[model samples]
Target: MMVRLGSSASRYVIATMAALALAACGGGGSSTPTPTPTPTPTPTSSTPVFTSPTTWSVDSGSSGVFYIATATGPAGKTLSFTITGGDDQSFFTVTSSGGLSFKSPPDFGNPQDANKDNVYVVQLTVTDGTTPVNQTVYVTVIKPDADVRVRRVGTGFNQPVYVYPVTDGSGRVYVVERTGRIKILDPKASNPAATTTLLDVSAEISTDGERGLLGFTLSPNFATDRTFYVFLTNASGAIEIRKYKTLASNNDQADTSTADVIMQIPHPRNAHYGGWIGFGADNYLYITTGDGGSPSDSDGNAQNKSSLLGKVLRIDPATDSFPNDANKDYAIPTGNPYATSGGAPEVIAYGFRNPKRASFEFATGLLIGDQGENSWEEADLLLPSDYGTAGTAPNFGWPILEGTHSFVGGDTTGLIPPILEYAHGTGGQQGSAIIGGYVYRGAVTSLQLNYYFGDAATGNVWSVPTQSIARGSTIKAENFRLRNGGFTPDVGTINNVVSFGQDNAANLYIVDADGDIFIVEKKPTA
Candidate 1:
């Protein structure tokens, strides 16, 4: 919501009609008794008339300080105004009547880089001691439309964190570009020419900043087993997931090669490796991992169900190796609530401090997004009958608790809370980190499909509807009457809203770390 600039004075009426036609051409052409022809006095252009209260709103609650007023020329004369763009203009307090109040600006830490749909042009000059008038404001800042739309398509991509898009049902999209390349766009090419580079892995991933080649999946029978899966971090930091087999003829992917590695996890800390992979609805293969980074959870590994880090794993991969005997490449779906207690049998939800993105609701398979820490940021729905047909055990409390409170005490009893929770401090408007998404079921959007997804480290985008959620017998969960809709995000710039895929035509895709790839449609309605 911080992409500001819309106080709307008829959209800045060309600097207020050229400052009222230069104040009616400097008024004065007298002739009293006889001394008449004394004209030629034209030099009075004093423009600086920005009246007060065009629009302003404030409500920070947990704190104080909010004064507004910023005057400059016109009414009386001697104009003066100077309160440029923002970044905390000393917290703001301009009153000579031009009013400009402020006191709540830092909590956006990185909220998707405060997206104004990628627009930045700020100017506010109004002086009249010697004439100077300029006005150009156009700040949009959006993020809450969710038919996803990270679109940048492709480029050289060096710090390209993660993209993961896969579509092959015809219009050809397949993105995946976390420096370990793979970019093919082909909207039926002839000259579609948007982005291309099937797969590279920069000689085996590891591009840093939370490590690269983050996650991808495409093998629910990719038309005819073109097979795919990736979740990298390799080059020594560890976390691998590997598996590929494309060959290229028309699927457009060209060469893939390696066919199996399935799992790794070492990660001595390059950054929270909550990689994020999907294939839920029982086809088995759901991963999320992160308590391995720094900050609070230090080494308790987010509740240590025998260290899979923060945990959410459920792999089966259909075999290539690494199954039984504890852990190697994958297997462990025997319902996994810690399968047999010795621990790492592929966990299946345990505490979690960085469950980046987990979605599945292609018509009520439930299992929604997760991301909570610091002050709060969560969203969950689960319920495939509570994961019994296979994919069981779900605790999700983390470091004793966070969205319901109790940061480090123990026994949150049955755990599992959060149907929605936001607030990261700084007078609390919300958002620090939590970018989980998807619950649109797109065909073009009528909207209420029980929406429940999130995003914000400043990337904005929010929705929380599954009827507003209630579920309470102590397992914790409550979110009522909520309605924060702003920033309409569906234009561009989306780094790390990571996983939201769906193809075979239910249509929905929003993967981004930098290797952009949007496509969430539904704004038509003429």
Candidate 2:
């Protein structure tokens, strides 16, 4: 070290001498080393990821492979994908081609369909062989408690039990009151309301429990023929299907004077008046009749091929010939099973408890909701294989067999078992009556052409695979919640699901005994 000099010239001389001394000693003294630079990492996508639906409708069978997701990794780079989450990640996978597929089909049942287990909360990690990019996403599965809902649309009617739509290209819907009045509704109106009375038969009909104008259907040629039919319990308690034509001046108003008693069946008992009429694609009138009313079916009406009481009858009331039959009101179709069997020519199929509701599936033939006696309620899937081919339409086991279970001395031999059945008082609700509905051949994509039906007492709705019905597969149904508020109603509080109806657009509606109606709708977000 050099000491400070007193003068500037002396300080300059000392500094130059010190620098020369330090430079000569540098090779011998300790020296500091510089650090190696850290090269900046090659830039890549901030978050390279894939996309999938928020939810997916589980398929009916194991064979259907639905695309669930797709991805595109970093450009000009190879991608290696792996997903990790859920009980088994094998159910969902990401392919090297960036396509996602369902490896395992989901069954809408317990454990496999539980809320927690039904979701795949996967961490998608994609690698370009050097660095990995990660993303998290959720894909929900449809189980018994599906993501769909039933929303209330109309309320405050006089004990409305059924609502129907006329596919007559008029965009008009009719509401039938248990009080014996029919009202017209413009369904497409922003706030659809029924204000006009189309027909009133309160003076001629008796309105009571399990009785009244139970069935109504438009004639196939209603757009031109202007004819329709109403099945009702007249003041004398006789079940009648009477024909009426719309007034020429007003399509909404019918000519009461032109009411012709088409066909009337005597079901004097107060219970089990099967009152559901639907025109098949063949244009023949098909009607469902309950086993002559009583607790255990004291009279074997359903088993008897001689009576029209507990049977599905196919007749052509449009002709009004009545040439050979005893009642001579309507002509039996030549295609009926009993037409040549020396049996009641009106009987198309027999053995029903209370075939409460029936409707065609458009492409497939028929589906019937049969009310149970004590334990089970069933939805019957009828096809040409079931009816048009053989001995007769399938004989649904009623008193003979409640569901697939044997009952008190009930006949199980040669009986067609229900495709699906649940215990009545299960899941904190009771299934008192089953209201059969249409297969959802509607605009809702998630519904997947499913058959929608529900229990009247529980207000719990369910959807079965319509395709499974065609393939004769026994896939169970997924349940839909029908609540009071937008999504929540008091448990077991649907009043009474009296009947289900569908419109020309294939949209479905529910009628209740509490004088209200609800429309089944899909979730846009879900």
Candidate 3:
């Protein structure tokens, strides 16, 4: 290795020796070859996410696990669910397996949510021991058919006969008592049973038979004029539709001193004084009167075209057609069937035995619940054609035909039959007295546009589809029972229903003659 040669040969020998030394030392030409860098491991899983629908619907009384939240997370990691934050988050709880449940059963009518709407909202969180993923979810509580029930909102009424809404946005209702007293009720009050007397006509009204303060309604212009009307049997046993004004000092109190008699009709008997009075869509006062009492309309008042008894009368209370007479202060509406010369100017439709209650379906339709004789009870729906001059006036075939079945005697020409007729009995759908109700235009979706009526004698409630109230059609009705919600202390079937009412919001009410005011609501339980 020390032998020397020429310069080029010496250089080659030196390089070779260096290369061999390097090889022996296990070294490369490049200064220590950089070690292959270990790559950062790729994520084994993605961020946790909700794999369930954000919106869900459950039956009103649903509790426990109605919905399940599914999520995907890291391998070998447990995905957990939780209600993080939201207006109604306190109403719900979640499990490690992602099962979402209600802490308490929900009621569609009385929502516990922050908004108090049936739609419930919550903030849902999902995590896998990492950064939490969040989502806003909504759950709706649905009202089932079995969930419709009546809950007592007011009590201690002295035989409440009718309930009228103030419609002044005050949420107050005027309850008319059979003893000639009107009281104001705040259903949401701390003590709903406590009431303030609005008016007392006990001294002026006769409470004989089906008399006394029978019906009450607010003037269409009540907000401004503060005028209201009452239907009562005066001490002399005459039907009187009187007008009164609310005290300017207090919206809840009426002027108890005096009332103006809008119209007064002499009746032969006390029992069949049709008492319901209301303003129609035409801004005219519509008065319902029964046939001069005796069984089978023995006096033939229902068939007589000139008699106002046994008829629905349309009159303009704002005008004075009978200026010379104080008993008939109102003017006949122009479109009244006999406004010109055909019949009694006030009579719009005749041949009703005793239309105890009637309400306008809208502006153009009138529904009358006429109590029957011994065979049948009936409800008649009168359209514009039946009351207006453009069409034949409705002749409900009272004495001549007792609800599509021939009974006594009358001219059979152009008779309008009852749209709904039921047998007279206290069993099943059969009922004795028919109490007319409004076409439900309330917040309850299932009851919308359905016509409701009740039986005072049988204590049964029934409803028929509005569309089924057509001529020449045989329609059936359904038993519409607003029962007690077994989950809580609730009022069961209202007995001796005197009337049905509607508030400004169109929420329907059932008036029990035994001193209770019930509101239609969702069954209060899960």
Best candidate according to lDDT:
3
Report per-prediction Cα RMSD to one decimal: 24.6, 29.1, 31.1
TM-score of each predicted structure versus truth: 0.30, 0.68, 0.70
Judge candidate 3 against the unseen true structure and give its global Cα lDDT, from 0 to 1.
0.76
* Residue-level lDDT tens digits of model 1 in 1-526: 0111123212111111221233444435665454456789856435664443332222211122122233455555666555665433444444333333333332222222224232223344557666766553332223344442323333334444344445644556556656677666643343423666666777877777767786777777766877778788888878888777777475556455555667787877887777777787578777788887767685788787778888777778876345463326666666666566656777766777776666665423334455665767665555433445332466677778876778876887667676667655321124567666655555655344545343545443444454334433121112211122222233445534555554445455555555445555555544
The digit string of per-residue lDDT tens for model 3 on 255-353 reads: 866578988888877788888999987898988999978888989898888898999888899989888898887887778777778688888888999
**Model 2 clashes, total count:** 0
Instruction: For candidate 3, give the lDDT of residue 275.
Output: 86
Q: State the local distance difference test value for candidate 2.
A: 0.65
**How does candidate 1 fare on TM-score?**
0.30
Best of the candidates, TM-score: 3
Task: Locate the minimum summed-lDDT window of 10 residues in model 2.
Answer: 4-13
Candidates in descending lDDT order: 3, 2, 1
**Candidate 2 per-residue C-alpha lDDT over 1-526 given as tens digits, one digit per residue, 9 for 90 to 100:** 2211112211111222233333442333446554566999987664455543333333222222233334455778766667754444556666654344455554535334324565655556666776666665554544432544555666667877677886766655688887888887665555544457878898999877688877888898888889889888898888888889989988789899989887878885888877888788788888999987877777888888888887888898867566555445677777777776757887777888888788876433567888887877777755544556424656776777777777656556567766566556533123667888776655566664566777777665566554345222233322332222222221223546778887777677777778767666564473
Error of 3 at 200 (Å): 0.6
For residue 352, model 1's alpha carbon misses the true position, in angstroms, by 0.5
Please give the TM-score that candidate 2 achieves against the real structure: 0.68
